[model samples]
Target: MRYERVYVIWDLYDGVRTGVADLDGTPHYFASQYDEGPDDYSDNFKLYPVGTEFMRRAARNWNIYRAWERKFHNGETDLKTHPGHGGIDAEYDELRSWLDKQVVLLEALPSLYRAKFRELPNQEGLPGGMLRELEVTWSPSPV
Candidate 1:
């Protein structure tokens, strides 16, 4: 018989804030691990704070919107054929609006952590790449 298991790993780092990624490379919530156990994964696995979280949420929200847009454009899912709902167009718009606010929130995370690690170097050895692979079982992009 064969079996599969799952586990979660956590990492703690100093001077790293907990939050989402921003357009400007800012380290937020540096400490944390992927949701899964030792394996191979590739993704940004870090618990973000409210502001950064909002941004991350927005990005995800937009992704959903984009998917819907593709589906609708490709005639895969339409209101006429699949009535009862107005399709995902409205949802896409709403998500886009929320994403704007999220961007604003994400922009603030860097400033919040600036004073904390101002003197320190920007790049601190964080286990993002390795942890993603170990926990998610996916290959990460070359750093």
Candidate 2:
């Protein structure tokens, strides 16, 4: 199935968000939050169409990030003593660098693809709807 959009649900307060759809808007192949998680029904979202190589790379990087996370958590939690610390750390750093680069590119590529976000209703006297175009940001995990 060819995906034409990406569906991302994020926490505005904690930056703990996960992608719910594929590069083209279908659910990710692997079972994840997209399949069954708290955010499955979340109303807050950022939707972006698949348009550029950078966006594609971000999706791929997210896949790698998931794999790394599984490996990192399933085995060794101690980076200082893990046998594959060098390789693991290198991969982690690379992911971090890619994340950092995304931040920089957000300013440069704002016009490449228009992005939209939807917010849930609240009683804080704030209006909610499709607000403004916000650049995409990825947080590997909750802080």
Candidate 3:
């Protein structure tokens, strides 16, 4: 018997949490990772105060990672240099590195700011944590 590979569609979203638009105007980011499954395995969205550059780059690189992973898993031959400067794998590595650095920065935020991420009362599609913890800092709570 033969088995097929599963390619999960990973996506990112940045926006104000529902019902909290009036409370907090700041936007948050979250990633949703799932395939043709019933439920959406997306994590809580979090704010990323590092600026739009980080978010833009992250989205672009994520697409690269998704495409590359599919190619690698399916044993595709075009796993060579992509539109980016380095090879496909290299581009993926760069994305990982950038992500790691961002995580570290999030972790380093002062406790006062970091606590906001956890204090979010409603988990209504809002960012729960950073990529793992790089969630942005906010002045007011969106409760």
Candidate 4:
């Protein structure tokens, strides 16, 4: 099996247990791996916090988005039948822009955030037992 850290985005305000998103803003949490897992999947997965950027339109244009979302979920792809489809695509583009901004914001934080995150459970070369003794000094982003 390939061991890799996935770059998953989440809306921070979403309660701790659910990885849901609120389309009106930037993702609040980013996890490198599935919280608990073995390939959890859903057709709606792409519509959840994982692909929140595309979810932006529900706020600005609810009706158009609802129609498009319904058809897409129902597998109706014809442009004529799905008049709202174009708007989804347009919002997706905007989502990409939002993602770009989030990347910039993440980069501005201390580099140790990434390095430290990777060392999770235990830092490099540390014994597994050390995990129990670990203490972290974390600070929220300030900008």
The lDDT of each candidate is: 0.34, 0.37, 0.38, 0.33
Q: Write the candidate numbers in order of decreasing TM-score.
A: 3, 2, 4, 1
Clashes of each: 16, 4, 9, 1
- Candidate 3: pairs in clash: 44-127, 44-128, 45-126, 45-127, 45-128, 46-127, 47-136, 130-134, 130-135
lDDT of 3 by residue, 1-143 (tens): 11111111133334323111111333223222232355653233333333455555566666675455555545663545443435446766686577557644642222111112322334344333322212223342232
lDDT of candidate 2 over 58-89, digit per residue (tens): 55555554444455555634345432344655
lDDT of 2 at 128: 31
**Tens digit of lDDT per residue, candidate 4, span 8-121?**
222222222222232224333333223335553211222123335433432334344445545555566545644333444565456545645654444321311121222235
lDDT of 1: 0.34
Question: Lowest summed lDDT over 10 consecutive residues: which window, candidate 4?
Answer: 108-117
Listed in order, each prediction's TM-score against the native is: 0.26, 0.33, 0.34, 0.27
Model 2 vs truth, CA RMSD: 14.9
lDDT of 2 at 55: 51
Model 1, 7-30: lDDT tens digits are: 211222442223333223332322
Worst 10 residues of 1 by lDDT: 1-10
**Ranking of all predicted structures according to lDDT, beginning with the best and ending with the worst:** 3, 2, 1, 4
